[model samples]
Target chain A: MSKVRERTRSPEGDLPAPTPDAKQWVVYTQKREGAPFKWAGTVEAVDTELALQYAREHYGLDEACVGLITYEHGDSVDGEYSIGPLVPQKADGTDGDEWLVFTLAKRGGNHQTAGTVNAPDAATAINRGTAAFADGKACNIRVVLASDVHETTDEEMVIWRTHDMTYKLAKGYSKQVRSKWTRIRDNPAYEQYQKEDIETHF
Target chain B: MQNMLADQLANIVLMHADDKLMLGHIQSDWTGLAPILEEDIAASAMAQDDLSHALVLYEFLGERFKLDPDAIAFDRDPCDYRCCDLVTIPDEFDWATSVVKRWLTATFSQLGLHRLATMTEGDLGDRAKRLLDEQTIQVTHLNRWMTRLGRGSIESHDRMQAALDRLSSSAGMMFEPPDATLTEDESFCCGRDELFTEWAKGIGITLDAAGLSATITLPDRSTGGGRRGEHAPHFIDQHAELTEVRHSDPATSW
Candidate 1:
């Protein structure tokens, strides 16, 4: 038989609907003052207050530390966008690594591009830094590799990998402490590489 | 100084802390699950705050009584629990009812603490005063949610009010005394003989009158003595769930 016999599952298999009882949401916890937000554990709730309450009880208690909880929401914009629908825009299934580039600016100045982030695709790369944006500006933008601007090599953009983001985060208390900040001031280079290697969408 | 007061304080603290522990777990179920992102975060934060509050009381009780906090917290059967009937009722997956319960409970507790703050003596008095300070924060947060839902949408108001009517009879349960194994002589807990009546008459009356009425039917606690280890089916179910994990390896670290 021709290739018409070939079959594949739909992308819908990857994303299941939220259950009526288990309301799942990403919780961003502020563990410390100046650190960038690291991914915290997920929790269930019926609504916003209930979700926050759940996060506080599960993550905030037992440890005599201060923390804040927020239902990690998805968003979109110019330089910023939600990490969803990881649509790999390739023809022949040849994909490599794409890095997310961020340039943190202060007072309207040219934000010296922070660093390149590893991503499977351009859109995926852009999402790793979206939650940091506040107003109309990309709180952080792209700095593709050694080149400090929004440059992307054809090889880097088309490359794909299954490198999950989970391995990079710490296991326990350290991860708990890492979830507080809005941005990364240190180790910009490493963060840049990470943006390209993984897919992070809410 | 008096042993009776000490026992009373222990009982009071145990009840308060136990309620917080359970509610804290229940409240945490909402994390990342709320209808709105903003409200989700805010509510989660309060859950952490409540747990923190419980920890303080638990620690105090543990230290004063020379007992392990976890023992008192996880080891007790629901029948042995002294928490009022108000906190025992299941939220039944209803968010509005949960909020109303918290609002009403906090109001009643705040009143209890308020009266305690005026005590001319005793460490319990001092602790109550301190708790009162923190309790206000919870009171404000809960009250805000209630008013928001109460005044904003007609549907919201109706949902909350209906839940209130269904659970209205349990409000008085908060003031009722259990048949607690704790006695004035045992250094367990005290003052419940008339504390519920006094608290209702003194503070509850004002709160009920001040636009917070939903109708509270005080449980006839005299019929069943929970404080003395006589619990109903609801409590047994609760204890089974809460203790299942803890008893798995009681002597080991969780």
Candidate 2:
């Protein structure tokens, strides 16, 4: 409650510093249940669990959101990477892996989840992505294979394990806006208006 | 009797709006100062929801009372506003306290809205239901934080406990009946007894989930007349801040 200790503390001072293991996670939010999940934004969390919480706070709070899905940045491979056989002279130019495609139709627009295309590599997936989903307005497109995803179980989430670090979770900041409020409430103008206000009422 | 009921209902609605407006103002103060960046944005978003709800309620009141929404909100004197003492509690700069306060207030608001939704029919009922929809996110956000802090680190648990202790006395003020006259209408959707019982049960469930005790008792209605047009002792400060811009150079529009 004392202002001295609370006021001067630094931001993120109590929270644990991000370790080298922290990774960026891309989040997709579905505004309502059964609605299309749109690319919302990104969050930097040490793990998927923290990413979910941060993603909820960052993007989910502003609107009527129902669902959120996060993908680790490293788990995804771009379709552009497999551009070797652009014009595949032979029939065997494609691999058999099914790559999921996503498209960013406009600048600053959310990347809609496009359907998947079976291809030999990431580059072929990009071509298939363009052919299947492109409407001539796509600014960027990405593709990732299904096999690269590393899903963590609930019991494995490390976000809940920081028992020694209380400061990071909730104790780092102190705000004094109401201290001035207390003084302002005791002003004579307020006292004067209290009586006058009653008179104005019918 | 009908006229009295109308007056009492309008007053009750205004009190609801007043509570939301003051809470919105206080929470907005945490916009840039929250303990964490994500929390800062979340707090601002919740504050926006509170203000938005207040705006809707004020507009509803305007329709009934034949007053402009702006006048209803900004032109009122300090003692005329009917916001609860819990929303006016001074910022102790403690994150746990802020989150806990939000949790408790949001819980009470949710229950009140539930009772309202079930009690009234037609326009008032529709508005209550709509406001309840918007409150879903705030309730979820606050509940999660309450649980996390309650069961998180030892320091967090202790801080949360201390905040509960500090806030327990006035938190019950939120459940106080709007006004004695309002409850005289048999058609009214809910009574104070039902509201208090539902609120206590809901809050107990939430607190118990957060690893905290569920021992809240109602405060005396006489002492909690924010709903009766009796402002808290510290309400003038909030009124000063609220009216400062509008009152300054009253000749020009802000």
Candidate 3:
């Protein structure tokens, strides 16, 4: 047995008290230049910088995202989530700080960037955003201060590399792995393995 | 002189490849078990990046040496592997230790990759530049974790400090030459003193922000260690685990 395996593992005595959870931040990603940012997910982070970094590592690298934005969860005001498309309300106003608007197309779908509305506060921002972007197609309307929405700069746009990144993607290996498997196993066995892989692994 | 430079480059590349392979192997075990769900995904993704980066380096080495990349990665003898002891040490599933170790290594790797990227050699400079871009994500993520956990709470701060203290000794060994044949000038691809200075400056900024401190010094190159092909027992176990699948069916293709 190796020394590491043979050494008696000591019990971890008196584990430290758990720390409080970090603040939550919502993340959005843009697929390409001039593309609309879509809701990606949320991450727990201590601050905006950390949140954006986490988002880049988690959401930006998940696919081929070209841009990412994040805002503190507490900063955003979400309107009522309706079962059907929201009626275009007459809440037009342009009186204060700009708020970026995002609209949910369906109940379980992601929110996409709709545009921006000028309002004094979050509530007004949502109302004005709904008035501006909710074209009777959005299931929900959300608004956050444009200032609060931190974005990746040109230098920070290293989210996607120019190099071939297929190694991390399953599809990158699918064809090559399938060919290798076929060379070793029969067609039926290979097909069954591939099916199981898609069902179980994917 | 050219042959000597090539050997030194090969040695450095192998060291980095081995380090990534072991670190990725260990970290990948935490895929389903990280402290948080998002962290689990992020760590797993970074681990995948590490593994993929290792493959790229190995491919470069294979192209230079006329060998298969897979064989270069998995078929090496224990002494032929050049990963530092720091990467091979068991984190024992301790999140603080894992984060701290990765942060330290990532800082050093960023500097190393920067040097490699600047080289006039063939596609090596371009390849390292590509790897360096992805490596920025890992370093940034780890740096955030380090700072977050360090300033988080007393318990969190203490754990991070302890992890840094524990790994401080082994961390310097990353600067050791991977091959005995490498002269002082050849060992560091760039000058050792210059690399250490830049690396220390980068580490100092993160450590300062993280509210952490460690006494990480350059190890004496004359005193050989893991990069000199002398690995610890933990590395033996790690290598065994890493090669088990490859060894199971040496003739089979994955």
DockQ leader? 3
Model 1 over residues B76-106: C-alpha lDDT tens digits? 6565566656665666556777787777677
Q: Estimate, for each residue in A36-133, the C-alpha lDDT of model 2 and write its tens digit.
A: 56777777765555667677667665344566667788766543322222232222334578776777766556676767778887767777677767
TM-score of chain A of 3: 0.78
Best by lDDT: 3
Candidate 3 stretches greater than 4 Å from native: A1-15, A80-93, A106-108, A153-155, A161-163, A167-202, B1-6
What C-alpha lDDT does candidate 2 achieve relative to the native structure? 0.67
| Candidate 2 similarity to native, TM-score | 0.70
Q: At residue B172, what lDDT does model 1 achieve?
A: 67
Clashing pairs in 3: none
Q: Can you give the lDDT of residue A148 in candidate 1?
A: 17
For model 1 chain B, the run of ten residues with the poorest summed lDDT: B181-190
Residue B234 CA displacement from its true place in model 2, Å? 2.2
Tens-digit lDDT track for model 1 on A53-156? 55544554433223443442322112533233222223232244534244344334333323344555655555543433222343445323222111112221
State the TM-score for model 3: 0.85
Model 3 / residue A120 / CA error / Å? 1.9
